[model samples]
Target chain A: EPEVTQTPSHQVTQMGQEVILRCVPISNHLYFYWYRQILGQKVEFLVSFYNNEISEKSEIFDDQFSVERPDGSNFTLKIRSTKLEDSAMYFCASNLRQGGNQPQHFGDGTRLSIL
Target chain B: AQTVTQSQPEMSVQEAETVTLSCTYDTSESDYYLFWYKQPPSRQMILVIRQEAYKQQNATENRFSVNFQKAAKSFSLKISDSQLGDAAMYFCAYRRSAGNTGKLIFGQGTTLQVKP
Candidate 1:
């Protein structure tokens, strides 16, 4: 099975610095999404992208957070002026079709630790 | 707002036995989707099983099965003949069947321990 792959399984960044997390969704998948899971907390949706633009985002996805499909395969999440609260495991996911009926495949996840 | 709840923080079962993890959700929308994801010690999120709200029959994947009660808004996962590999943190998630942007709303998770 084709799986979503994330780069830099672990990332340590200083506060107030910018960090970019990269993901390569399954080659044929159409929709892409980003989710955050703070230790001991439920996973929270960050943003969802489709057709090269953001389709939806959660309140947690503030102005400091942005997502882009730099190319046909790469989907990147960039955080500006990171904070301690930003430390969490970030998961990238993709689905072959629209709607919730289709299962979303997940990546191994990137652990972002902020100092 | 839709919220998924996993009341059991942790559960234990002996190898070769059976165990069930509980999950409930608060949602007014009649149509939606439910899923079970397992995060082992390696911390990789793997899909276990999924059930569609519209389907009257429960979803099953080999040893993994779901008991879905749409009216009660309850979805639980049952592991039959459990094995040591089943030990992990299990999460119950919900997604709306309607919208195009299908972001999953997840539960806090339940840690399952299998003793050999």
Candidate 2:
């Protein structure tokens, strides 16, 4: 089965540096999302992207976060400045339809570590 | 806003036995979706099963099944013939069924241990 794929399985950066996490969603999928999980914490929704725009975002998705669909299959999340608290596992998910009821397929998360 | 709750932080089951994980949610929306996801050591979030709020009958996928109580706002997962491979962190999630928004609200997660 086709699945979402992410690059740079692990990322390490300094506290003030920027980091971009990349994802290649399922080819036919239309909706994409980003979620993060702090170690030993629940997975939290960060943002959702559709039609080349952000559809929804959580309070956790603040000014430092931005998402882009630079190409047909690539969905990238960039953090302008990293903090120790920003270190977590980030997951990329995609669904075939935009409906909330559709099941989303997830990619193995990219573990972000801030020094 | 919707909130999913998984009260159990951890659970263990004997190999080949059965186990059940509990989940509850608070949502005013009449139509919605509930899901169970498994995150193994690899940290890959895998969809285990899902239930639609409109469906009165519970959903079953092979050894995995759900007890969905729409009126009570509860959705629980039951794993039959549990195996060692089933050991993982299980998360319960809720999603609104309307509009173009597809964000998932996930619970804190229950870590399951299958003992041999």
Candidate 3:
């Protein structure tokens, strides 16, 4: 089965540096999403992307966060300035359809560590 | 807004035995989707099973099955003839049916330990 794939399984960056997490969603998927989980916390939604635009975002997705679909298969999330609290496991997911009833497949998350 | 709750923080079962994890949610929307996701040591989020709120019959996938009580707002996962590979953190999630965003709200996970 086809699955979502994320690059740089682990990322380490300075506190004030910028970081970009990349994902390659399933070829046929139309909707993409980003979620994050603190070490011991629940997975929280960050943003959703469709048609080269952001469809929805959570309060956690603030000014520092931005998502781009630079190419057909590549979807990237960039953080302008990293904070210690921003260290977490970032996951990318995609679904074939628009409805929530459609199940979204996930990639093996990228673990972001801020120094 | 919707919220998913996984009551059991941790559970244990023998290799061949059975185990059940409990989940509950609060949502106003009548139509939605409920999902169970497993995150193993590798941190890969895998979809275990799914249940549509509109379906009255329970959803089952091989050794994994769900007891979905829509009216009671409860969704529980049962693993039969558990294997060591089943040991992982299980998460319960909820998603709305009408929204185009397809965002999922996940509950705090339940850690399942399967002894060999």
- Give the per-residue lDDT digits (tens) of candidate 2, residues A1-115: 8989998999999999999999999999899999999999999999999999999999999999999999797999999999999999999999988675568999999999999
Range of the 10 consecutive residues with the lowest summed lDDT in candidate 2 chain B: B94-103
Cα lDDT tens digits, model 3, B1-116, are 78999989999999999999999999999999999999999888999999999999899999999999998999999999999999999999999988547899999999999999
Q: What TM value does the first chain of each candidate achieve?
A: 0.98, 0.97, 0.98
On the 0 to 100 scale, the lDDT of residue B51 in model 3 is 95
lDDT of 1 at B24: 100
DockQ of each: 0.79, 0.80, 0.83
List residue ranges in candidate 3 displaced over 4 A.
none
iRMSD for each candidate structure, in the order shown: 1.3, 1.3, 1.2
Candidate 3 clashes: the total is 0
Can you write out model 1's per-residue Cα lDDT over B37-114, one digit (the tens) per residue?
Answer: 999988878999999999999999999999999999999999999999999999999999886488899999999999
- Give the interface RMSD of candidate 2: 1.3
lDDT of 1 by residue, A1-115 (tens): 7889999899999999999999999999999999999998889999999999999999999999999999899999999989999999999999988686688889999999999
Number of clashing residue pairs in every model?
0, 0, 0
Clashing pairs in 3: none
